[model samples]
Target: MVRPWIGLVVLSLGVVAAEPPKPVRVPLKAPHESTIPEGPVGEAIRLGQKVFTNTPLHAPKYSGNALSCSSCHLDAGKAPHAAPMVGLWASFPTYLPRAGRVGTMEDRINGCFLRSMNGKPLPTGSEEMRCLLAYVWWLSKDVPVGAEVVGRGNPPLQAPAPADPERGKAVYARACAACHGEDGLGSADVPPLWGPRSFNLGAGMARTSKAAAFVKANMSGLGGSDPLSAQDAYDVSAYFTHQPRPDFPDKVKDWPKGGKPADSRY
Candidate 1:
C-alpha cells in the first residue's frame, strides 16, 4: 500500500494550472487610397478623409478643441490600435453602458464630438455627417456584422502597479513635458493633455487605465514609439488625468443603471 504522504505528492503532481485565454486580434485591412472606387462615392470618401484630417479647417464650428480626430485615431482612423474606422460599421448599433442603452452609429459619432472634441454635435443630416458615414461604411465594407476587429482599440494593459502621482511629476518632466509642455497646454503640433481644450471628464481617455494603455502604445507622439515603462505609464497617466480639464455637466447621467468604473472622475 502507498504511504499517505506519497499519495498526496502523486495527487499534486497530476494537477495542472489553468491557462489564460488567448487575446484575439485581426490584422487591419482598411482599403488604401488607390482602392477607392472611381465615381461620386469615391469623391465622398476623399472628402471624408480631408474632413477627418483637418477638422479645424472643415468643421470648425463643431470643434472646440485644437485636437483633430487624426490626433487620436491616427492616419485618419486607419491605423490599428488607434481606434481604426475599419469594421466600425459592423460593430455599431450596439449597447454602450455610458449611454445606458443601445445607440446608432450616428449617435456614437456625436458622442465623440461632445466629449473628445469638447464641441457641439453635428446635425444628423449635415453633409459632414453623411460624408463621414460614407467613408466609415466604405472602410468597413465586406466586414461581417458584429465581428470584432483586431487593433480596433488600444490593447488592454495588464493591471498596473499602484500609481503614485507624486512620482509622475518627474516622469512627465522627463518624458512628456518637452512635447506637451510643462503646463500641458500643448503646442501647434501637439494636442493639450489637460486644461479647457482637452477632453472632458466624461471622455473615456480621462480614466487612468485607458490613458495608461494608450500611453503604452502611442504616447511616443512625434517619435511614434512607446518608451515608458508600465509603471511610468500608470503614474504619469494618473498625474495628467487628474489635472484640471473641461467638465461635462451631463456626467451625472452616465451609467444611470450603475457599473461606474472606479477611476472615473465623475
Candidate 2:
C-alpha cells in the first residue's frame, strides 16, 4: 500500500520543501556599562547587576543558598548559551510548562528566588526587584519585541548513552574536583554543584538533562579550554544532581496542569 506520508514526500520532492521556514536567531549581546544612562535609572541598573552577580551578598534575606543569579546565568546574564538575559525583557509574559500559566518577568525572577536560590520571593515592588527589572530592560532594550536570540539557554546535546552516575563520578573527579571540590562544596568564587548550600531540588539545574546541557556547553567557565563529550557531560551531571542537596517542599505545586519533565526527581 502507498502510505500517505510517502505520497506527500513525492509531491514535495523532499521533506524540506514541506516544512515551514525556521526563525533566524540574533546574536546575544548586552550594552556596555559606559552606555548606561546617567540618572536614578542608571543607578538601579548598576545595583541590579551587583545583585545578579552576588545574590547572597545583595539579597541575603531572600537568598537561602550561597549561589547567585550569575551562578547559572553567567557573565551577569550576558553570555550566550548560558541563559543570557539579553532578550528577556521582550520575551515575557511567556507561558511556562512547569507553572502551566503565562507569567511576567517579575514572576520569572521570583521563581528563581523561590527555587534556584531556595529562598523567599522578592516583593514585586521591592528595590531589588525594581533594580533587576531595570537591568534586564537595559540589556534587552536593543532587541526587537519578539526576536529570537541565539544562545539564550544551555543547548541540549544528544548523549550516546543514557546518563550514568557511576561514569559521571569518574568524570567529576577528573574534570570538576579541582574547582568544585571533592565534596562538591564550591569555594567563595565558584557555586556549589550539590550540598545543603547549593540550589534546591526544585531548581532547573537539579535536572540531569539541564545540568548536562550546561556542562557540555560551558563546564569550567566562560572561554574554557577543554570540552567534554556528550556522554561525559550527561554522566557527570547525573552524578552531581543525585547527590544530597536542599529540597523544595512546594515541588508538588509544579506542573499543576501536567507536562512534568521526565528528568524531574520528584
My TM-score estimates for the predictions, one after another, are 0.86, 0.90
Model 1 lDDT-worst window of ten: 218-227
Best of the candidates, TM-score: 2
lDDT per residue as tens, model 1, 1-266 = 99999999999999999897554545678877788889888888888777788777788889878877777788888888877888889877889999899998899888888888888898999888888888899888856665668788888886457988888888898889888999999998788999988888888889998998888777744354347888888899999999999998889889987899999997
Candidate 2: residue 28 lDDT (0-100): 84
Give one clash count per candidate, in the order shown: 1, 2
lDDT of each: 0.84, 0.91
Instruction: Estimate, for each residue in 214-244, the C-alpha lDDT of model 2 and write its tens digit.
Output: 9988774323435688999999999999999
| Candidates' RMSD to native | 7.2, 5.6
